[model samples]
Target: MINNMNKFIAIVGSNSNKSTNRELLKYMKHHFQSQAEIELVEIKGLPIFKKSADKFVPQEAKDIAKKIEASDGVIIATPEYDHSIPAILSSALAWLSYGIHPLLDKPVMITGASYGSLGSSRAQSQLRQILDSPELKARIMPSSEFLLGHSLQAFDDNGDLKDKVAAQQLDGLFKDFLQFVNIFNQLNNAKEINVQKAKDFSWDKD
Candidate 1:
């Protein structure tokens, strides 16, 4: 059985301001806090990504990578801009691609909200394509796709998620994500152990 006694989860939102996306993330955080150690990673402080700065990525980006690497799973809540994920989110993903690739073989889930009628469905769909690339090394959950419509009205002025149905759905998503992470961690640990054993059992060994 997989032991999730110390699993760490990271939550990221695209917008830098008081965004509904952040509220969704916070809601997930609250849901998982009792079951796992949670860390909130804000992408707002990250500088715009540039390929020329590869050798020395900004500290904010570097910090985000480390957190992703250390966590067992990642949850992203993105906001739709013009029917697509925000450029800031894309930039952050681009920056992450150059590093050690902490997302490889990890469990990830994406959700979003929009002020328009369609919610962030288009943006979430586009994000799934970007995340599906081989470089990400993550398993995307297919059971549910969360897209909040009229997001500005869904949440209160304090940025709290006021919709009970959305809150419950977010809770369910985190629970499933935790289960996925536990299984993934178990397999990863087993592989590490086998690799170590193989290294120690070389034919040249006594």
Candidate 2:
């Protein structure tokens, strides 16, 4: 069971630089500032995933996996490139599929902003499809889509979310996301308790 005091959340993005996606994640962190510990995962050092090298994934990948395992929920903010999620995000997700499967049954939410008319909605949709693979086991938040358009002009040079309406929409999305995650956590705790009770009964019968 996750202690309310110890619960943590991880926010991930594709770019290592001052990306708009990262800025969105920063805003998310601020929204949750008083509620939970939010850790931003850096994908800069993660290597390209290779199937043959299952025995030794890169240290960076391992670090990310550990963080995912420790996190109570995950928020991803990714950019669109060619109507798809960035290659770096893809690589990280691919690497996470091996061994530990940190995303399995984990609560996840996705949001993004773009300079184009479609925002990063196309890329976010592609990522949702990828995350829905049977192997992932993610409890995806359906209502948490934040597709901010005109990304370059949406924020000031200081990286604040400039659009008041967009900010409010994002806030609402985060509130829903928090409720979903809390319910998931409760269900997980109940399942664990039931399993422990069953195990205890079996031991007594023997």
Candidate 3:
């Protein structure tokens, strides 16, 4: 049974104010309000990550991390830049993994939006690799790709998906994500070990 009170953190992977990625996440937040409580978080305005000897993490990053920690799962919406994830999103991930690993063993779902027909496929692929790293170790849902191509016209003025097929596809994937989260929660045998492993794997040493 899908938990009615499930909480999820949706990270806006773009820093641009005119981002369709944000629109997509917003749509999901409203579209699935009854299934889950989706909170959209921004990575904008976070300082570029710089390694500190003391392993300092910014307060903004910490706040986001806490939200992720408290949520049942995570959703990331990214826009392609140079055929990969944006620098701001990368910096946010660096800050997120610097000293605290909130994403360790957490369930993640990847989504992308793009102006081109190919969507942000390359960026989403790269993001999967990044989230699978030792520092993050997010259990990204397998084969759940929600790529919105020609995103400028993908949604209506009311912010709902215009295509019925695409809308149904997203609904299916979201239902799958809910099950994935539930199964992941039940299979927590390795969570402690994974967290310990992440903590022990130092960036300098690796």
Candidate 4:
């Protein structure tokens, strides 16, 4: 019984204009076009990541973090580069971990598209591990992995998944994900701790 209407921000973790990952994200947007409000976001505007404490985090980066904080769910569509996640997505996670944790306990889904047979499975696996690290904590649904392999042939000019079998399976995955969102939301609220406990256990990195 999934009744909650969640606002999800879809982020294609690549900066290239003609990215296959972006196309995949577009297909996902169309897949659930009427079910939820899906907004495609980019990370090109974010300033370069700083490692030192003296320098300040970019305002644009902060705003993006805030946006993710406010959203009910997140979708990260990444391309596998060198058998791992790209720097763009990883950099964004580092900043989001700082200045308060917006990604903390939020429901997220990771998908990837690639020209290779594995799709972005390697990148997604790495990303899932990163999500659980102290740098960030996002509640990732353990559902079907939407790997759009051979992306060039898998999608059409309009970005709709052309493969009927893959499309049907992904459609089912989305329905389950929406339900996962509701359950995850409940757990986040129900497990919220007292102020002292929150401060003691919270990985705000403050």
Best by lDDT, which number? 3
Better of 1 and 2 by lDDT: 2
Give one digit per residue, the lDDT tens place, for model 4 in 1-206. Answer: 12455789888798788898888878778778778777888986775566665436778777877788778899999899999988888887776765446777788888888889999898999999998765466788895588889987887777788899988988888888889998876676633442224335534246
Q: Please provide TM-scores, in order, for all candidate models, with all chains considered together.
A: 0.79, 0.83, 0.97, 0.88
Over 4 Å off in model 4, which ranges? 1-4, 189-206
Worst 10 residues of 1 by lDDT: 195-204
How well does candidate 4 score on lDDT at residue 173?
82
For all candidates in order, the CA lDDT equals 0.71, 0.74, 0.94, 0.79
Instruction: Kindly report which residue stretches of model 2 are placed more than 4 angstroms away from their true locations once superposed.
Output: 1-8, 189-206
Sort the candidates on TM-score, descending order: 3, 4, 2, 1
Candidate 1 Cα outliers beyond 4 Å, as residue runs: 1-9, 156-160, 187-206
Total backbone clashes of model 1? Answer: 1
**TM-score top scorer:** 3
Clashing pairs in 4: none
The deviation in Å at residue 57 for candidate 1 is: 2.0
lDDT of 3 by residue, 138-205 (tens): 99999999989999999888999998999999999999999999998998899888989988888887
Give the winner by lDDT: 1 or 3. 3
* lDDT, ranked from best to worst: 3, 4, 2, 1
Please write out the lDDT profile of model 2 over residues 105-204, one tens digit for every residue.
7889888878787879889898898887644556789856789888878877666788899889877887787788888887775444443443343212
lDDT of 1 at 129: 85
